[model samples]
Target chain A: MSTFGLWHYWVVIVLMMIGLYTVIARDNLVKKVMGLNLFQVSVIMFYVSMGKVEGGTAPIIPEQASGPVVYSNPLPHVLMLTAIVVGIATTAMALSLVVRIRETYGTTEEDEIRKLDRAEHE
Target chain B: MTFPIEAIVFLFLLATALAVTHLRDLFAAAMVFGVFSLLSAGLFTLMDAVDVAFTEAAVGAGISTVLILSTLALTDPREHQQPVRFAPVAVVLLVGAALVYGTLDMPYYGDPTAPIHKHVAPEYIEGAMTDFGIPNIVTNVLASYRGYDTLGETTVVLTATVGVMLLLGGLGGARHRGDAEVVEAAGDEEPTPMDRVQVARVSTTVLAPLIMLFGLYVQFHGDFGPGGGFQAGVIFASALILHGIVFGLSSLKRVVSPRFLEIGLAAGVLIYAGTGVASLFRDGTFLDYAVLDHHSAQHGRHLGILLVEAGVGITVTCAMVLIFFFFAGRRAAKSEEPGDRDRRVA
Candidate 1:
C-alpha cells in the first residue's frame, strides 16, 4: 500500500468526526454552520481524491507528449463543479437565515433564541 | 515534489477550518473562512482540477466571504452560540459509521481499474477527438452530450442570483447600494482607500492582458486540455476581482454597470439555450448541433460546444460577481462602528 493511500482516508474520517463533534457540541448556530461547511468540504476532498489516477499529469496536456496518453478521470472535476456551486448557494442561504434569526430573536445563541421563541409563543 | 507541498496546503486548510469554528469574533471567523477557502483553492490546483480550483477560489474565498461578512453587518457581532446536544450527535455518528462501513468494497482512490472510467466517460474521451473537435472529455460532457446539464446549471446561477437579490431586499437599500442612511451608521470594519492593495503598475500592465488572454485561451483551448466553461468563468471573474481589489471598485463599476451585469447574465443563458434551439430547428435534439453543419460532424459539434461553453462562462462569471456585491457591500458600508447606536434591525 502506498503511504498516501493508507493515511488519506483515515485523516478524512478523523476530521469528519471532529467536524461532527463541533457541530453537535457547539452552542452557537454559526458554529454548527461552520461544522457543516467543514463536513461538506471533506466530502468534496473524498470525491476529488477518488478521481486521481496513479502517475497522472496535472490534467494539462504536455505539448511534447504524443498520442494516446494516460490521464486521471475528469469526471470528479466535473462533479466538483456542481458541488462548488451548491456550496456557495448553501452558504448564502445559511447566512441569510442567520441574518433573519439575529433580526427576529435579537440573539444568535441557540438556547437563547429558543427561550425568546417560547416567550413569544407563550 | 508534491508530497511536502500538498501536505502543507492540506494541513493549513484543515487548521483554518478549525480556527473558523473556534473563533469567538464573527469577523475574525469570517476572515479565517476566507483563508480556508483560498487554501482549498490551492488544494484543488494541486489535484489538477483547475476549473474547480478557480470556482472555489472565487465563490468560496471571494464571494462566500463577502456573503458571510455582509450577514454579519446586518446582525449582531457577538451572540451566544448553541451547545451540541449529545443525543443528536450519537444518531448522526451512527448513520455516518454505517455509510463508511458500507464502502469497504469500494475502489481505492485513483485506482485505474475503477468503475467510473469503465462507464460513459472513457467513450466520451476516446471518441471526442473524432466525434467533436474538443480534446477535453469533461468539456465534451458539459458542453455537448450533457449540454442540457450546463443549461440547467446556468439556470442555477440565475436562481441563486434571484435568491440573493430577494434575500437582500432587491440588492439596493437593505444591504449597501442606494442606502445612504446605512453607511452613516455602519461600523469601523471598512478598510480605508489607502488600505487597498494596488497591483504594481508595471506588473498589471504586463499581467492584465496576459490574464485576459489566458482566460480566452482556456475558453478556446479546452479543445485539447483539461478546461471548460466552469474554469473559464472563474478565470474571467478572478481577473476582474483581482483588478477590482487592486484598482478599487469605482473604476471597475464604471467599466461594468449593474444594468450591463444584468444583461450579461441573461445574454449568456440565452446563447446557451439558443444553440440548442438552432439544433432543434435542424431537426436534431435540443443541443444536437451536428446538423448545424452536417458536412463536418466533429466541427459542427465543436462549434456548438464553443458557443455553449462561452455562454456558461459568461453567465457564471457575471452572476458570481453580483453575488460578491450582495455579500461584500455590507462590510464596505461602515466608515465607523456604531456600538452605542440603538438601531433595532428587523
Candidate 2:
C-alpha cells in the first residue's frame, strides 16, 4: 500500500481504457452500455480518490464544539451525489432508448441493428 | 494506520472495467460493466463520497444496466456493425488528453489545506454555523455562497424537461410506419392481458409511501448528512419511477400525469427564477436574499438557499423522469398497440 501513489492513478487510467474498449468493441448493445457505465464510474473514482486529506476524518459536525477535528473536504462528496443522480437519469434514458431499439430491430446485436438501419436508410 | 488499499482498489476497478469492455460476449460484457460500476462506487466511498457512491451503485450499476438491456431487446448482438469513424475519435482524444494534462500542474488531490478549501470554503463553513446556526457545511455552501448556481442548475432541469417533452410529444417519423406495430401485426396475440409490456414487480408496494417519506427526509437531511434538494429530487423521481416500473407505466400514468410533469417542470423552474428575482425587491443585490426578512442574515441565507434547492430538486427530478418517460413513452405507446406485441424482449 505504501506504493499507492503513481500506480493507483495509473491503474484507474488502465481500467478506464478497458471500459472504453468494451464500449467500442462490444457488439452487444447491453455490453456497450455496461462499458459506458464503467467509464463513468472510473471518473467518479478518480475524483473521489483525489479528495483524500492525509489525516482527514469524517465530514460530520460532532456534538462537542471547539474540539480540534481533522476532516476531509465534504464538497466533492456533495458534487458526487449530484453526479450520481445525473448518472441514474442517464441510465434510465439509455435503457429507454435501448428498449426502443429492441422494438424496432427485433434483436439487440449491434451489427444487425446497424445493417437494418443501413437497409432502411438505403 | 496500515497502508491504505484505496490505490489497489482503484487499480482493480480499472482492470475490471477494461476487461468488461473487452469481452466479446454481449451478456458477459454488460455484467462486467455493472461490476465495474460497483467497484468505482466503492472507490468513491473510500474517498469519503458516500452519497455519490450510493448513487453510482444504484444508478450506474442498477438503472443504467437495466436500460441498456431494454434497448438491446430491439437489436441483434452478432451482426457486424459499421465501425465508428476514426477522425472524430482522434480529435476527441486529442482534446481530452490536453485537458487532462493541463491538470498536472494543479495541486494534488485531497489537499484539504489547499488554497481552495482554506480560503473560501473554511470561511463559509465557519461563517454559516455562526451566521445561520446550521451545522451542515455542504448545505451552507450550496445554498448560500452559490445559491444562484443552484437556481441555475434547477433551470437546467426545467430546460431538459422542455427538451424531453418536445422529443416525446412530437408525432413524427414515418408516423404510420413505426416498426413496433409491424412486428406485432404478424404475431398471434398472447394471453395474460397486460404482460406484453414488461413492468417492474409490485410485491414491494408497501415500500412506496415509505420511499416518498424518505425522500422528504433526505431533502431535510441536508443539514447533516450528504443530501439536499438534488438527492431528494432524485429519490422522489426514483420512487415515482419505481412505481411506474413495478406497476407498469399505465398504472403510473394515472397518478403522475405527463401534463403534471410538464407543468411541474415549468412551474418549479419559474418559482426558482422568480425567487431570485424576488430577492431584488428587498432592495439588495440580485439574490441578495439577506434583506428578505427570514430571521437574520444567516436565517435568510439558509431559507433562501433551501427554497432554491427545493425548486432545483423538483425541476431536476421531474425533468429526469419526464425524459425517461419520453423515451419510455415511445415503447409504451408501441406496446399499447395490439400489433406491437412481437417486440416483447429483454
Candidate 3:
C-alpha cells in the first residue's frame, strides 16, 4: 500500500486534532462539549475506515447474488454503533452539567467560574 | 480514478469541524455541528457502515443538535472572550502526532489478511446464518457473541441518565413545585413562540407518528438491515422531542409523565439483566440464550436477542426523553428565578 492510500487516515487525524484543539482552547462550556463530540466522531470515522475493504460492498447479504461477495468487516461498525450512542449520552450529561454551572455560577466561562469559586473559598 | 467522493466528504467534515470551533455564535455553531454530523454520517455510509451512519444521522445530527439548541435557549449563546493559549495547542499537536505515528503500524485499508479481518469478524460473517440465523452479521455479533459488552454499554447509558438527573434534579422529585412558575417565565422571555407556529404544529403532528413507525421498523428490522435498538430508540425519542417542540413541554409532560419515564429507564435495564438471569434458570450461563428454548438453540437465541434488543430500545428511549425533560425544566426554572439575569450582568 502506498502513502497515498493512507490519505483518509491522515485527514481523519487532522480532524481529530482540530476537535482536540477546540476542546482545549475554547472557553465556552457548550463549545467544549461540541469539540469533544467532534473528536469522538472523528475517532469513529477512523475505526470505520479501517474496517473498509478495498472493493467490498455493504455488509448486508443480498437475496439473488450468486457469486462470492466481499462484505466489509462488521465488527468495527458494531463497536462504533455502541460508541456513537455512548457519545450522545456523555454529551447530554456534559451539557446538563454546563446548564447547572451556568445557573449556579451565573456564567459559563471556565475562568470566571474558577474565579468565583476562589472568591467563595476565600 | 473516479471522483474522490470520500475525500471530498472528509474535506467537508474537516472544514465543518473548524467552522464549529471558530464560530462565536453558539446557535450557528450548533447548526454547523449538525452539518458536521450529517457529513460524517455520509462518510460512514460511503465506508459501508450503514448502521453507524443511520445512528449518527439520528442521534448525532438530529437529537444532539436539538438538545444543544435547547441548551442555548436556556443559556447565553455568545462565547466569553479568552486570550490565545499556546499550551493546549502544543499538547493537541503532540498527542495528534503520536496518534498519527501509531496509525502507521496498522494494516492497510481493508486488506483481507489484516489482523482484525482474520479474527472473530470472519466467524460472525460465516456463521451468522448457521448459528444465529440472522442475515445481518453485525446484529448477530452485537446481540449474541458480544452480548455482555452491549449490556455494559446499556448500563453506562443508564448511569449517565442517573448522573444527569442527580445534577439537574429528577423531574419526579421536582414536580410538586408547580411548573406553572417556570412555564410563565418561559412564556414571558422566550424569543420565539414556537408553540404558536401553525406550520410547526401541523408538520410535527403529521410527521411525528410516521417517525415513530420508522423507529419501530428500524427496531425489528435489525436482523436484516442497518438498524437496531440504539438507532430505533433515538428515532423514537426524536419523535417525542419533535412533538414536545411543537406542542410545548407541558403538553409533552402531561402525555408522558416523568414518573413513567423514570420507571421506564430502570425497567429497561432490569429487563436486560432479567433476560440473562432467565437464561440461567434454563441451566445456561449468564446471558447465554441458546438454552432459552428446548426445541432449538437458534429459536432460543432469537427470542433472547429480541427481548434484549427491546430492553435496550426501551431504556434508551426513556433515558433520552427524561434527560431532555430535566434540561428543559432546569432552563425554565432558571428563567423564572428573579434577579438571575441581573447577577450575570453584575
Candidate 4:
C-alpha cells in the first residue's frame, strides 16, 4: 500500500508485542529472559531503522572519494552498539539469577517458585 | 526483478520471535532465538548499520546462543505446560496498540529529513574526516564523541561480572570431575558418535587461533571499517569458548587461567577510566582527547580512542569468558557432586 514506510514500524511493534506477551504470560524464567531479549532487539531495530536514509551507504567514510556521499545517521548506530552489549550484560545477569533461583527452589517455573515461597511462609 | 530481502528478513524475524515464545521446548526456543538474532543482524545490515550488525551477530547471535545453551545444560529444558492466560495477552495487546499509535507521527522508515538526521548526526557525518580524521564514523562517535557513555557501558559489563560472581561464585568453583567418576562414566556407556568426531576436533584446533587473529584484526582495524572493541572482544571470547567446548573446559582453563580473566575484567574498566584521568592531568576536562598530545589534537584523539577501545575490548572478552565459565562450571560442579552447594573451592 501507500503506507510502506509506516509498515516497517508496525511490524516492529508486532514483534515487540510478541516479546511482551511472552514475558508476561510465560511461567518459565528462561523463556521470560528470551522474551526480554526479543524486546530489546526489536527496540534496537526501531532505532536503527530511523537512522536509515534511502540512498545512503554505511557511515564509514571512504579514503578516496569521487564526489559527496550520503551516509546513514551514525548516532543511532553508535548508541545501539552499546545497547547490544548492555543487552547481553542484562541477559547474563538475568540468566544467572534464574540459575540461583533454580538452585534455591529446585524449579525454574515462576508459579512453582511462588508456591514454594508461600508454603515456606506458613 | 525486485528482491525485497529486507521484507523477507523482517518476516523471518517475526516468525522466529513467535516460535521462541510459543515453543515449550526451552532448548529449541533458545536455538530459534539465535536464529532470530541472526535475522535481526541481517536487518541491521540492510539498514546500513554494519557496525551494529557486526556486534549483534557476535554478541547477540553467537555468544548469546552459547551462553543460553550452557544455561540450559544446568537447568530443565522443558517448559512446563501452562494454561495461556488471557489477562496478560490482553495487556500486551493494549500496550502494543499504544505503541503503534505513538509511531503514527514518527518519521518514515528512510526519511532523510527526519529530526534525527537533522540533529547532531550531520555534524558527526560531515566532521568525521576533518574532526577525528577517522573513516568509521560510528567508532569515532562511540569511542570519542560519546566516550563517557561507553565508559559507563564498560562499567556495566564489569557490574554484570560482579553480579554473576556474587550470585554464582568465582570460576574457580568449576573443579574437574573426579578422576574415578570420569573413568566410571566412560566405562558405564558406549561412546556416542559425537565423541568420534575427530575431524571437528582437529578443525577447531586449527581454526581457534585463526579466529583470535581475526578478532585482533577487527579490534585494530575498527578505525577504518565496521568493527570495534565490542565485536572483537566477543570474537576473542568465542574463540576461547570454542576451544573449551572442543578440548574440555579444564584444558581451556589451563590455556587461559581463571585468575587472569578475573583480573582482566576489572582491568578493562580501570584502563578506560584511567585514560580519562590521564586526560585531566594533561589539563583537559574529563575524557577530553584534544589535550592528550602537546603537538597535535588529531594524534591525541587517535591515541585516546585507541586506548579506550582497547580497554573496552579487554573487559568485554574477560567478562564473556567469565560468564561462560560460571554457567558451565556450575553444571560441572553439580554433575560432580549432586546437591552440594558449597563449591567455594577457590
In order, what is each prediction's RMSD in angstroms? 4.5, 5.7, 3.0, 3.7
TM-score of chain B of each: 0.78, 0.77, 0.92, 0.91
Top-DockQ candidate index:
4
lDDT of 4 by residue, B251-294 (tens): 66768766789899999999999999999999999998888899
Cα lDDT tens digits, model 2, B1-346, are 4125675766677567656645565556566667767777777667666666655654654345544444443344443444655754565466446645655555556555565566555666566568766666667666666766566556555654554343333435533443233223312222233455443243447667887888888788777776777767766777776776665555666677666777788777777677778788887677666777755886677667777777777876677667655555554455556364354322
- Highest-scoring model, TM-score: 3
TM, every model: 0.81, 0.77, 0.94, 0.93
lDDT of 1 by residue, B1-346 (tens): 5657877887887688778767888788878877877887787777767666766765675556656655776776654544447787786678568656755667765577888768876776666667865556667766777777668877877777767655543233444433233222222333345344444644655676677678787778876775666666766766675555445455456556555777888898999999999989989889988978878877788788888888887887777666554444434542233342333321
Fnat (0 to 1) per candidate:
0.42, 0.45, 0.76, 0.85
Give model 1's TM-score versus the native structure: 0.81
lDDT tens per residue, model 1, A1-122? 44345345554665576567767777677766777777877777777777776666544445676776766666777777767776666667677666556545666677788787788898
Per-candidate local distance difference test: 0.67, 0.60, 0.84, 0.85
The Cα error of candidate 2 at residue B128, in Å, is 3.5
Candidate 2, superposed: residue stretches over 4 Å from native: A1-3, A22-34, A90-122, B1-5, B24-29, B74-109, B112-119, B172-202, B335-346
| DockQ leaderboard ranking | 4, 3, 1, 2
* Deviation from native of the Cα of residue B154 in model 1, angstroms: 2.1
TM-score for candidate 4, please give it: 0.93
What is the interface root-mean-square deviation of candidate 1? 3.5
Ranking by TM-score: 3, 4, 1, 2
> What value does DockQ give for candidate 2?
0.39
